[model samples]
Target: MSLPNDASEDRMQMMTKTERFSKLFDELERCREDEQMQKMEEMNGLIDEMNEEELKSIFTIELFDKIHQIIEEKTLPLENALVLLKHVGYYRELKIIYLESFDYSLLRERMKEMIIDENEKKEEINEKILTDLCECYALLGEDDIFGEVLSIIVPCLLKVALKKDETEEAQKEVEMALLALGNIGYWVEKESYGNEIKEIIKYHQEHQNLTRLAYQSAWEFLIKRFHNYESLEEVFVNDLHFAREARREIEELKRDVDWKRKEETGKEAKELLIFRKWIYNIDNYFTSCKLWNEEVEKLLSSFVQMIREFRDNSKKVSNWCFFSITNAAENRNVKIDDLLKSGAVDAFSEEMKQSTLEDKIVYDCLYFFLNVSRRLNEKKDDEKKEAKRKSIKRKMFEWIEEGYEDVMTSFHAILPDLAEKSKFLQLSKYSSDYLWSL
Candidate 1:
């Protein structure tokens, strides 16, 4: 009654795909420790080869429940388990199961244990674990759980962020912690943790010890959580107002015709130095948000004045002014006419003539010109559609014509050297290509 070889082969081919997958799963479960990794790899390969319908049919709720059980028992490393979930395209389902099955408490307890153990060892925290834990809590969005997690995670993050004489690895840890804090900031109850988080970030923002990258992360966190104009306005403008008052006093003193008084005023003007740093940090936020209404108009006007007046005294402030204006113009939210009338064109043109200016400053100036020129070209393209458009284009064209020669002369003088520098090569290439096209 034994089957022939051909008949046996036919019977093996007749086995359904799901039956084969089930055999693989059983083999994986029974595999020895040394073979488990190989089995998982094969499973992943088979899963990839299966079509969506086949996958759906094979990966049933029962199988998922088994996977969850394995995860809870720590049969596999957490990262490896998460990766498997990702490859299987079941991360969302897994998230839902975890949220609904009261598994967050388990995750929370694990995180707390890990933090305590690391602290006891006086070791750098495991950033990857904390990041994953935070991401899970963020997705769950349960306020109480989020608050508890935040309370634990924030202290650990601050410890890293505030570490003295940190190693390179510790610096990286600080970055990861800040990024995680930012991601977690999106889910926490603003009333309870918002001000607390802001205070921590503000400390970093004003702290002299932290790197620029740290300050940037702090600002990004604020922008992510509180995106409104008023919130940002309070952070940037309140301090800026004091700086502006001091600037005005310095300006008035410049016209005093008293050499002694002017020198005294120059010393006081140096106080505005800190404001320049704050302005540099917040300018991109202002430009990206397009907070160009009447209130910010004063700020923009002040920038134009700063470029004209402080160009010789503080190139840093001047460079930032050009950057803010360039960003605003690039977004096309600020009117080109307003920028032209504000003497931004003249200021930048003058800066371009300075042989000793930083390549970055010159790059910003050229970028501003490139943006304006591109905008002008767009307006010109629209001139054919309407008479009113033609009139506006004509005015803009005339305004640019007045400055066109000087701008191009500056561009030509700098293009050769700029095209050679490694740091500015890409931008210079872009500028060269755009100028040639025109």
Candidate 2:
């Protein structure tokens, strides 16, 4: 070659290289234009045959090749490339195609495109895009996608929720975004992003326009994601709204908890140990929130279905019930009477009395007396129903005052200096004014 490289030989070698590289690239560009034209023709032809699904399927594969080639050639803008990926069901197909070709450059570029699009729209109206993106992220259920979308979505929703000029629509959108983040962060175990999502949720709930939505969303999130937190009982006892909302969520979560645990914990335990922990937590949580009447009723139904092989955890259950209600009332200004009248207190006393007499049980006893005192104070004197109401009220106060004295006697026996403790001092005086308003 060095000895006698003629002009023809040199020209041939150069042409061969150029032809090998440039020919495919030119064909790719032409194929893309053809694909676009064919799509339009297909739409027009649908006026007769009208096979929309078939038309979409046909175009999807055709465009995939064209876009793949274009990507390899690096002959188009990244945004334009992403446009082809966004067609109905195209992204999933592209996922398989890219995996086969072993060309991840396109995927990497797509990720970049997502980031760019998110940033650009974040400053403008992002409700639709963010909602769609969250849907995609949730459907994908891949940690990478979930984490990526959640990181941006939480902050942006927080920003929008905090804006003074934000609309109700914007607030609703923020709720959806927060819900999405909670799903990914909790269900997917993205602990790295969980705290951030929690913070954003707290912020959204703090905003005036979105408080109701935020409460609703936070309620859903905890049930869906952190229903099994070790401190769930504490949270339910301390937070009234959280406790009430948790009751609804726990009902829904119970159905899927076994399957979810099977997926999350294989071979560790055939059945879910987490379910028992959940029950333990929920048992206490429901008591704290005054959802025990409903939850216990559900538990009784479940127990009926699986008889004779019971776990004999009534002691734990009783203790939880007693402490949760008592502490909830003691710390907060919550009246046990209101809880009872709301129908949440039905059958709870009976359940507590039958259960073990732990510290938690003692708390329930205290609440029972509180409820009786409250009913006594609110005894109505209607002329038509006076005798019946008064009879009920008199018995309730007698029972309640006697019970209160008994508990105090027990407290004095257990802790002789109990009267000097600040805990008893914290009991709020009966609010006749508030009761009258009701």
Candidate 3:
């Protein structure tokens, strides 16, 4: 069913990127009853080859307008038009994401015309075409003219999401729209638009229609707007959905039995890492806010559990948790004592023996200790806090006394293996300062 690697390469070698892209659409346009699905798959595969020259070269405004004229003048299928635009959206480069309101209007109108109105004005909305358009706009976030397109596209996406209970088709459309909104969420700068997104995220999540990835994407989208306004931060303080999303996802991962077996290899591994990324992001969002509330406190506690539970799972999981603590610590509000109280030091110490920690972890751990020593130094003259500092230092010493120095030694011993001198120097200073401070 799949093209062999060498054959795929040979096919590629015969055509330049633009040539291949142009030809794919030409084939898609004339493709018949027996070959549609295969042709679609081939078009989807072109996502990898998508770039500025190939896209701009193939779809000049004149060419695009001509296609529009043809679609209107003939009873032509509009699927290839949306498919081409979807590929254009997939080209992630922002400068190339040039949008024209006329182009947007044309696409929307053509999709409407695909199945025309009749008596009772009976209209059949093509969910599949709508799906492609939702995705295209979602991926086309923050383009030069995206602000203009937002008023046009955002409402359409929201209308789909609002119809969540109407039909199975609407529910599927809701899920698709939520994800599409998520793709463009962070780029949302308008408060009205951001609030609309925030409420939609809440509604779908409460209805149990939201996935963890979609939920994460919604917040990531909102943070751009949320960060600039105090009123927005109150969204977190007043609501529990954000924390519930984190807790629900973490609990699911822990309960995922198929993901736990040591010998397993599949999507579980990739998905676990994705879960970790989502957690890390929300974890940072909690810390970034100046306002503290129940959601923040609860999620921080959840993060602690995330580190302690998954530390021994796998190197990837271990490093993932390591990154969580390291990143969370960037915010001073994520107090060091809380991490220690949750056994972060003991958790990391377990990872030090016979464990292969990554270089980035080594970097963060070094600065982490530097920050710790500085905190200790801040309280050095306070006799009242002496016992507290010592008690904390003792836990840290266990990580080093157990196997940390050896880990550091191995890293420094092969310093030349480092590709960049700045990184080498930074690591060198981090190591030297951390050891000296300890």
Top candidate when judged by TM-score against the true structure = 3
Report every candidate's CA lDDT: 0.53, 0.40, 0.56
Tens digit of per-residue lDDT, candidate 2, span 1-438? 354668645654565322422333344355565564444333333322212343334334334456555656666444344333332222222111112221223443344356547666645845545445433333223334344545565555445434444677766555544444433434444243445445544554465444333444444445444544544433333443343333443344445344433336332121222233344444433433433344344443332222211214223333443444444444323444344444333334344334344443444444444544454445456865556556655443433322433334434343323223436433323322112111
Instruction: Give the least accurate 10-residue stretch of model 2, judged by summed lDDT.
Output: 93-102
Per-residue lDDT tens digits of candidate 1, residues 223-292? 5444433354455445333234323433443343233432464332212423443454346554555434
Candidate 3 contains a number of clashing pairs equal to: 2
Q: For candidate 3, which ten residues in a row score worst on lDDT?
A: 113-122
On TM-score, the stronger of 1 and 3 is 3
What ranges in model 3 sit over 4 Å off? 1-26, 41-77, 81-134, 140-146, 204-206, 211-213, 227-231, 257-277, 291-314, 379-432, 435-438
Candidate 2 regions exceeding 4 Å error are 1-311, 314-356, 379-388, 394-409, 412-438
Off by over 4 Å in 1: 1-221, 224-273, 353-357, 379-393, 397-403, 413-416, 419-425, 428-438
Q: lDDT per residue, candidate 3, 329-396, as tens digits?
A: 65666666766655655555555444565656665565455555566545556775787777666665
**Candidate 3 TM-score, C-alpha based:** 0.65
Best by lDDT: 3
TM of each candidate vs. truth: 0.42, 0.31, 0.65
Candidate 3: residue 92 Cα off by (Å):
9.2
